[model samples]
Target: MTEQSEMYVLAIDQGTTSTRAVVVDHDGRIIATGQKEHEQIFPRSGWVEHDAKEIWKNTRTVVGKALVDAEINRHQLAAVGITNQRETAVVWDKSTGEPVYNAIVWQDTRTQKICDELAGEDGPDKYKDRAGLPLATYFAGPKVKWILDNVDGAREKAEAGELLMGTIDTWLLWNLTGGTDGGVHITDVTNASRTLLMNIDTLDWNEDIASDMGIPMSMLPEIRSSSEVYGKGRKRGLLIDTPIAGALGDQHAAMLGQACFEVGMGKNTYGTGNFLLVNTGDKPVHSDNGLLTTVAYKLGDAAPAYALEGSVAVTGSLVQWVRDNLGLITDAPQIEDLATQVDNSGGLFIVPAFSGLFAPHWRSDARGAMVGMTRFHNKSHIARAVLEATAFQSQEVVEAIEADAESVGVELTELKVDGGMVMNETLMQFQADILGVPVVRPEVIETTALGAAYAAGLAVGFWDGIEDIGRNWSEDKRWEPQMDEETRERYLRLWKKAVERTLDWMDDDVEELFR
Candidate 1:
């Protein structure tokens, strides 16, 4: 094998809004990076889509750009790792490699009626025990079912085994490895766990669920470990022959990247949404506290570790809505500057239930709202409230996690945070204050990509083991709670009040508008 120190891992992070590629050296430092944003297609109110072809194109573009930026070639990369938005379902023809329909984003709520029907028949928690998920539109199974039922000739093709279904990670992996030319169809346990079709205990597709949902079992991918050489890269624009080694859902990758290997260690990723996952060791702890039981990651043939996940539907995306829809700010980053101008939200609260609340309070009926706003409040206050919304949402999840952990006799001491929004010092500090725990930001904030890189590098013998990657983790900054108990209580109260106002928003009139 080549000296472990010399090889690089090309980690691809295909996200909701963008595609990014980064080259990481053995020491876990990002040598070079490239990123490109894609369009957010909203076919109608409460629906979202992404062109899989455009995503594939963006993947190639970013990979080429990263290689150029890093001054490296395909031969220099030891392996490729992929991390992507989980639960975004895509189905395509096996022969043509074209998606049957635009990829259904995880945030899309068009399947709510489908979910409601299923839950109504089987009860909302019917599959929760086996699948480790609730009957919600946030999962891949309903989305896949929606496409198969809605799209033209999809069911026939799927049942005939002429189609394939997978999450974004599986789609990218197939395209990266060989596309229509013998591309391997597979997904890691971490990604598979998000799909309601997978049995969390068996670590495979649940045949019963598949049958019940009317989904053809043949369309599913072979489940694989999070780290393994699935196949050799082929026909990729800039990468060829290199091993495609690792894959994870983005949030799971962040947990691995943060090196939260030990039980009770947790991390919060503030991406398009906010997700808090705590490593729950080998056994999946079924959450009675409105969290999801998920596979954190399964290394090569080892016992699949479990996690309790608190998924918030909207956080950073709220910032984008303020910028693009409301014109409150020109760019995402300016929210910080504008928000800092205010002492507080000026008694206003922004419950960005734009896609409804997720985690702890899975209120799909909720909608976006700016409550308690008066003439005295300005955009700066709204901006500050917007930023605070992320922190507040996270705090809700953390509270639930703490409750779940307490049941398991584990107490969380600190939170490890990563992702784009972690760069916002105000948000981080406020998050810390809200939880009353120190929020530690790793030196490598791009832990999602780094985690994928580590997985790929490990699989290809570029590193010794998990210990080697653990050494790469270093704390760059830490924020401790600053607000007094009274202030904290007041903020929580107002935030809860604002959240309550967003509920039951999809009334008959609103539903009629969408129709």
Candidate 2:
């Protein structure tokens, strides 16, 4: 066994594109990491899925690789933390640990019709007061309902108390603790807040909402706080008997990893999608705007910290589209270089509503559109348009946040950022320019995993408390606004016009084409 001073915590970051394991020491530095991408399954145009079992297998593989890379064994590990893609749901047999259907990704829009039917005459925000979320396809509750209604025998099995449904965090935690052998089935408040089933105020499942969605309460996991000893690793796994102490949705974990402890402190994570979250202290701040009120994190039995979140469905993934689908760049990093080739988008705007727009405009009928394109524009100019789209979308979300926070007297001065896309200098500078605020990056940009490790460390006495974790955060770089206000406003005006072209695109004719 290692001494307390030398012990390390491991974080399993099960993301949308990949599963990663990071080993972090007491100083909040990433000592070692292991990552592997999983296959993305698209059965139809609007549906996205992942193999739940493959994600579990990759989780174990990455953990083993990270431990070996760190030159440590299970005994040297203080605790295990898990942070994962929120709203990606899985339904599995409790006894067999096999998924009933493919894990429906958060990006999937198969449940739009379900959400519409549920909204009925009250519209999308019908249950917003109790749920703090509009009925949408981006959440997990409808996804669970989809599985039950479509999958053969899933409803029967669920009603009989044999099926289990959870986000990726719950799926990974259940298996990490012990699969098919007394595995603890649980999820943290952060993940539960995105499910549309858990009441944001009570932090418990709303039987009315679940019943409305035609979901069985028996399939839901026990909702727990973000930090605490959930269970121990299974005897068969590499982390045998180690305390599994922390679980958070990837965005909430990023907020914690950034050490945003004070009210009004916020962070933006640029990943497959971009999520901006601002801490609202102990009480939930209802948003009249498009923002969603969610539980930021709950530590042990402490009151849960709430947040107003603006979720954009496409950001970094747009870069992937440019690279893979458009063939504009051979790799993701090349996008920055390509974008810099042109002074601007050369009068081109790409509204990447590939899976419909999220955030301030929850237009499920919207589709991807590339407007303001001239014959003079080239691929390099297109690259600039792609990167600019991300910044514009983020700016809209920030404006909505500002509008909502006016009542509470909370203001966001700077945005702490993390995730793979932060490395793009072009995007970061533009993000700051558009928002007219400083965008700061931390020394450790892998805050998602680090946040999970912090929770685990605090829970198991590996670290003293939030203050100890806060001391480890240090700024690495900052980008200040450079574009003139006049020019920025002009560009934003054009971007909004481009966005308008995407709305109401999925009419009956469009839906019939997919069918």
- Top-lDDT structure, candidate number: 2
**lDDT (10s digit) by residue, model 1, range 1-515:** 65556669999999999999999998899999999999999989889999999999999999999999999888889999999999999999989999999999999988888888888767778899999999888999999999999998999999989999999999998988888899999999999999898889889889998887889999999999999999988864678899999999999999889998988888999999999999889988898899999999988877888999999989989999989998988999999999999888888888888777889988889998988978999889989999899999999998888777666556878889999999999999999898888999999999999989888888888888989989999999999899899989988988898888999888779989766
For model 2, what is the error of residue 64's alpha carbon versus the real structure, in angstroms, after optimal superposition? 1.0
Tens digits of per-residue lDDT, candidate 2, 1-515, equal 56776799999999999999999999999999999999999998889999999999999899989998999988889999999999999999999999999999999999999999999999999889998999999999999999999999989999999999999999988898888998999999999999999999999999999999888888999999999999999979798999999999999999889998889899999999999999989988889889999999998988899999999999998999898887888999999999999888988999999889999999999999999877899999999998999999999999999998776467878889999999999999999999999999999999999999998988998888899988999999999999899988998899889999999988878778876
TM-score of each: 0.98, 0.99
- What C-alpha lDDT values do all the predictions have? 0.91, 0.93
Q: Candidate 1: lDDT over CA atoms?
A: 0.91
Give candidate 1's root-mean-square deviation (CA, Å).
1.2
